[model samples]
Target: MTRPWEILTAATVAGSGLLAGVFFAFSAFVMSGLRRLPEQDGSAAMRSLNVTAQRPPLMIALFGVSVLCVVVIVRAIAGWPRPGAVWLLAGAIVTLVGAVGVTAAINVPLNNRLDAGTVLWSQFLAAWEPANHARTILCLLGCALLSVGTIRWH
Candidate 1:
């Protein structure tokens, strides 16, 4: 039978991986596709996207993963014998600070500016894409760390 920590660690890894994939999709295709459109169209599309992205599924993935990471940290610390606790904790921190923090600080604000028609497409994409890339990297790193933690623990 699987232990509780094992299950929690699995959740952490899976959630982080899911978020990383989402970020990667934005960087790989979504942004690229937006780039091909006229400036007005692209900005309008992105503004719409910002609103649409606040829906349940994406919200769950973005916020839920961070919550999962916290829970994993608690579980890992409580069971101090776990060899991978440190890595799990590190993963949690990375996701919280990099993915969530950056999103809240950089992307959301940029989106708001775009929605208000205060930002140009070049400016929006320039700032937004690089920050998103940072988010992608962090989420991927968190996934990798959590996977390692899971393996070491099990």
Candidate 2:
């Protein structure tokens, strides 16, 4: 039977690959597509991209990576470990959790409001940008830490 750590490592690697390849890439791809849309096609794609970009599909994926990163870090440190290992784990946790909060609390709320049609799309996005940026920063940092974990992991 596979060990629990092996299961977690598999999940983490899977999440890492998905977030890196699919979730984040989907948003980027959509935005790139939006940019390439004919000017007359107007704001539908842009609006959709903004809302789609704010969701936390990547958080679940990154959570798996965080688990694996911790496991690998523990393995690497079996003999001797640097202080940064703890910092890396802690930071990833904070960043990932914060990304979730930023999405659920701020971004999702705004997306709901936008979807409700109470606010104009441009106005909604104007409000959405800051929350979106915060979540993006948190996720990006999580990705960076996870990347470090991937490279440093043995």
Candidate 3:
């Protein structure tokens, strides 16, 4: 009796929540721990992390959720005026723009600069942490919206 859209919406909610938690971890303690280290050590550790993050698990989670957001957006638009369409659309947009977009536009570039040894660790932290916080908030917001939308859908 579960419809495809229902499944998709549920998955999106879960995915958003997962990403939020990941971002929150970084904002909450990972970055803090890094900051405690000497500048060169911190920078080196972060660079290593950046390389590891490009691997499949995190990449799939981030990009796979992104792909789902796109689908959810299309579904929300096409199914407009339905019970939870607006909430679903809002959730997808928030996640796509706030989380994924911010990561692509801001965080990755900062990481690249850090990796290349082009930017100081302090400078990277100054910029990256705030952006990470923003994405964390956005992902949480998206998850909340999607959860409400899913409940309303039923």
- Cα lDDT tens digits, model 2, 40-84, are 342465556556554676444545555665565565355236434
Sliding window of 10 residues with minimal summed lDDT for model 2:
79-88
Is candidate 1 or 3 superior in TM-score?
3
CA lDDT of each prediction against the hidden true structure: 0.86, 0.53, 0.89
TM-scores for every candidate against the unseen true structure: 0.93, 0.53, 0.96
Q: Assess the local accuracy of residue 149 in candidate 3 as a C-alpha lDDT between 0 and 100.
A: 74
Model 3: lDDT equals 0.89
After superposition, the stretches of candidate 1 with alpha carbons farther than 4 Å from their true spots are none
> Stretches of candidate 3 above 4 Å error?
none
- Which is superior by lDDT, 1 or 3? 3
- Please report the candidate that would top TM-score against the real structure: 3
What does the lDDT read for residue 103 in candidate 2? 62
Kindly give the number of clashing pairs for every candidate: 0, 0, 0
Per-residue lDDT of 104 in model 2: 72
Model 2 stretches with alpha carbons more than 4 Å out: 1-84, 150-154
Give the range where candidate 1 is weakest over 10 consecutive residues by summed lDDT.
Answer: 1-10
Candidate 3 residue-wise lDDT, 56-121, digit = tens: 988898998999999989987887877888888899989987678999999999998987888998
What lDDT tens digits, residue by residue, belong to model 1 across residues 13-105?
Answer: 888888888989999999999999999898889888888999999999888888888887786687658787787777888877766999999
Error of 1 at 62 (Å): 1.1
